[model samples]
Target: MGHQQTVSTTFTSAVGERIGASLALVDAELARRYPGDPGTRQPVHTVYVPADAFDAATVRSWGEGALAALDRHAPDAASFAAVLGIPDRLAGPVYDRVRAKLRREPVEDLRIDFEDGYGLRPDAEEDAAAARAAQLVARACAEGTAPPWTGIRMKCMEAAVRDRGVRTLDVFLTGLLEAGGLPEGLVLTLPKVSYPEQVAAMVHLAEEFEKARGLDGGRIRFEVQIETTQSILGADGRATVARLIEAGQGRVTSLHYGTFDYSAACGVSAAHQSADHPAADHAKAVMQVAAAGTGVRLCDGSTNVLPVGPRERVHAAWRLHHGLVRRALARAYYQGWDMHPGQLPTRYAAVYAFYREGLEEAAGRLAAYAGGGGGAVLDEPATARALSGYLLRGLDCGALDAEEVAALTGLDRAALDRLAGRTAPQD
Candidate 1:
């Protein structure tokens, strides 16, 4: 016993420090700044209007007008149900709630575009428009009629027009903050970013604006638009999503894919610049992978086809928009751009149908997994996470309510919250 020698199996101090450093790097890589719960009202699409055309009242009216058009286009609940292929029982309720939503707050995220939509207006005119927008935003904010998310899409900072872009941003922000204060849920959209420096510059400007406005450090958030090949694949032949996010300094809220612009960058024909185009898909895939687990939202571009004019043409356009929306949903991009009021109906129709059709199955799987038994079917941890996310998204979108999900999934509010927070599970 006295001759027995002690042996040490513990790691040396240097080796332990190296392991700690490796883990620290991994944690940093997986770090995320979530935008947090968007509350009960999450808009499925953002409707962009030219800067000159934007006003709170007019925007609300646009939504009402869109609802009226949808009503005329699909007169009865039965016809609407047939068009969207939802259960007849849900037809009237879905139509009613959708109309009510549109009437009350037609546009969720309204982007007052000064870039492509507004073009190069006269300086004086643009100044006037900017002031008017700020005034309307203030008014809407005071009245509580402001959409949950609202912002201006400034022109990009390319060398040729960087001055004008900064000028427009300064004027708009100055007026907005002066009119009371920053609107609740205000965000900026930086379009056609070609390099990481562009994002860094935008983030810097946001910091400056926040300081001037007396807002918090991260209050002035922005979403970047991936419109060019360079935006997806940097000049160095590597993906640029992570770089752009880093350059935003944790203030980036979402990444919007510009289908037409990206396709054009790839030299694709005008006839084939749709969201489902291969080039667009590749860009979106790169975006998803880079932004995964980062809480950065993704928005697909709009369908160029507008549902107007003759009945046949309108119907055809509706079919096209609906098809594209379905494809986006399949790809897990819940939000897209709605170019016209008419597209509103199809947007909701497709969204409601997508969630509705899979409700029961998703519910069963989630309930089984959450119950710990998992007796219904084998579920990997990732699959469990996906099921929970699907239900949570539906709940956020108002497609499914707390009580409904609870009844289907046997999960109460607290359990659902826990499920949402279940990023990892010990095996």
Candidate 2:
């Protein structure tokens, strides 16, 4: 028995040493990934610009301006991707304006009406513009010089999938796909989504597109726009929302809350509803909880109706309010989405704060544990709890991986053996 105990401890100690060496090496490699300094995290925001907001020169300026602001504020972000949503009619001219200036991938969302018959095929002008936008997207993806994330947002309807059913949607998506419409890294945004079946239908179309092109249709992603009356009231307070999400496992990439449409659906006056209102918080919480640790990013809805201007107060407060909304989502542990160029600084700030808090926490716990001395039995339940919490936070945020726990906290891999109430401090 004594010999076995000796062998086991020796093995664990040797393995812990190797793990520490490996972690040190990985830290060096992670530095190369620009994992950012101590005060940094990924600031991902979905950028939205109104169709009428900018002309050609104005559009280029906006794209460039967003880049500059992101660079200035959230330099540590892994990447930035935008979603441009507007009527199909305006996309071409808008694309012409912003295409040259954007450094990162900018997605395009075609505001289509699926409720109408056979889907509204655009008139000549709109068709031409959509075609041009499509061409631009293909050019960007195929050529060496285009943006990193090229995508599309098509429409969805309950009548088609529910009462009238999704046959109409199938036809519309087929046309979009056939027209050389879908782009690489394409994101199909489903508005008025009520169930997983709707998502399944979209996924089916993506597979068809893939087979046709000999590409991995499985790569197509969905961003559920939890808009419309159905999604907000929890689709008539259904008990199966969690099931709906599970059914959509392969399809969903993120969840987006549309406050304007959501408010209208819920029939609350605009005055009574704010983005951070308890109601909105409840709605967003449902999504954040649903998406937590599932790898699907959660995007908060837009603040809506902000003026692009020189005044710092309006922009400042706007950023601050949105930052609060974002922090709420972060506290719930969602990584990112939805911001204008001016709000870029807040996006970075929130992410930085998120990691900074964790890093500070981990450093504190490690220090205390080290000071406790090897084999120390001091049991301040409160301070001991902090060590477990620190380990979890680091694991959650990717600061310290699972293997590092053995070395850092001296915890073993088995359940119930976690070093929660005990530790062996370094000499």
Candidate 3:
């Protein structure tokens, strides 16, 4: 039906094959270095408790405390919405969901802190605390009372505390092994990491532990806490974060930003030290890029402002915390650190409002894209992936109901999972 071409093609299949062969090494390297997201349900926030202070009742107590705060201050949807400026359309739903989430799962990811929160205790006291932490965590996991994710934060790999940190981790892991096998949601955090060697050291520790326990390799994964300037930028003037991730050797699950420590490391005045500071932004931005496509999630730091004291003071703190959380969500930092239970209300409120505000539009666009029907906005596959991911996250956090998401997007959970590049669950 068409006219024949007059000229012969200059390139052939052989030429393309040669080019592919030449780039095979690069393809393999890319696959190794940037494996993309792991497609797991990342927790919305990580709550840190002192190793000695954590107990079976800690999770429930936090939930009760958060509920009490809601009752005392913003007792209803309208009042809570007024404090956080939630829209009328979203107020009741967000308020109801926030309360339900507090009652159901107040803390998603919990870290038993032996670092800053625990401070430097005597060797004996720290040892006892570490053992006790393992016992409580194992028991909680067995009783189905633990948060979905729970872990310990050992001290840094710095020379001063290197052996002590290793010893504490050993004791903790040994305790867990003795009690039973390690739980599936067990996490480890190595804080104040300033060099790639520290990450390597963590890997080594994990490997040695696995070998000694005869456990599977790569079974233990930890988070690298980026708190020092050196962790972001090396003395050789390169993005040290990339090297840190590399040194992790496929064992780093996430990178957590430390607000005050990082700001203070940058010489930020105590009064000016906040998560929104320019310095913190730069650190987190670099973290985001370094973590992108690397299967490592990013967590923003916590705001030290606690919603305690008089009702007026609590309201002000709630407003501040809510604004900060919303800002972080806008920047695509889905997870953060929550220092106190008081911040839980505003945290959920901001997260819910963010998803709810954009829900209709996102759902419409995704539905159109999935159905191959044109929409106002031309969306690429990547955008579809993000949109599906957004809705799935909302659904997972209870901000969006599964039925409503299915109705809005015209795609069920399995369809969403496929679009988001996650493996659908087996029937």
TM-score quality measure for candidate 1: 0.90
Per-model TM-score, in order, reads 0.90, 0.57, 0.97
Model 3 C-alpha lDDT per residue in residues 1-427, reported as the tens digit of each score: 5998688789999999999999999999999998876778888899999988898899999999999999999999999999889999999999999999999999999999999998888999999999999999999999999999999999999999888899999999999999998999999999999999989999999999999999999999999999999999988898999999999999999999999999999999999999999999999999999999888999999988899999999999999999999999999999999999999999899989999899999999999999898899999999999999999888877788889888898899989989998773421
* Candidate 3 Cα misplacement greater than 4 A, ranges: 1-8, 424-427
Predicted structure 3: clash tally: 0
CA-lDDT, candidates in order: 0.80, 0.48, 0.93
Q: Which candidate should be chosen as best, given TM-score against the real structure?
A: 3
**Superior candidate under lDDT, 1 versus 3:** 3
lDDT of 1 by residue, 1-427 (tens): 6698879887789998898898996666555444333323345888888987776566767787788777677877787777656687678767776776667666778888989999987778877887788788778888888878888898998987687788888888888788888876787889999899999999888888878767889888889999989988878888888889888888888899987888999999999989988888899999988777666788999989898887678778888888899899999898999888888877877777677668889889888787777766888767866777777777666567788888999887556656665433211
Pairs with backbone N, CA or C atoms under 3 Å apart (clashes), candidate 3? none
Alpha carbon RMSD to native, model 3: 1.7
Full candidate order by TM-score, most accurate first: 3, 1, 2
Error of 3 at 137 (Å): 0.5
Against the true structure, candidate 2 reaches a TM-score of 0.57
Q: lDDT score of model 1?
A: 0.80
Cα lDDT of model 2 by residue, 141-171, tens digit: 4653433343334446456344222433344
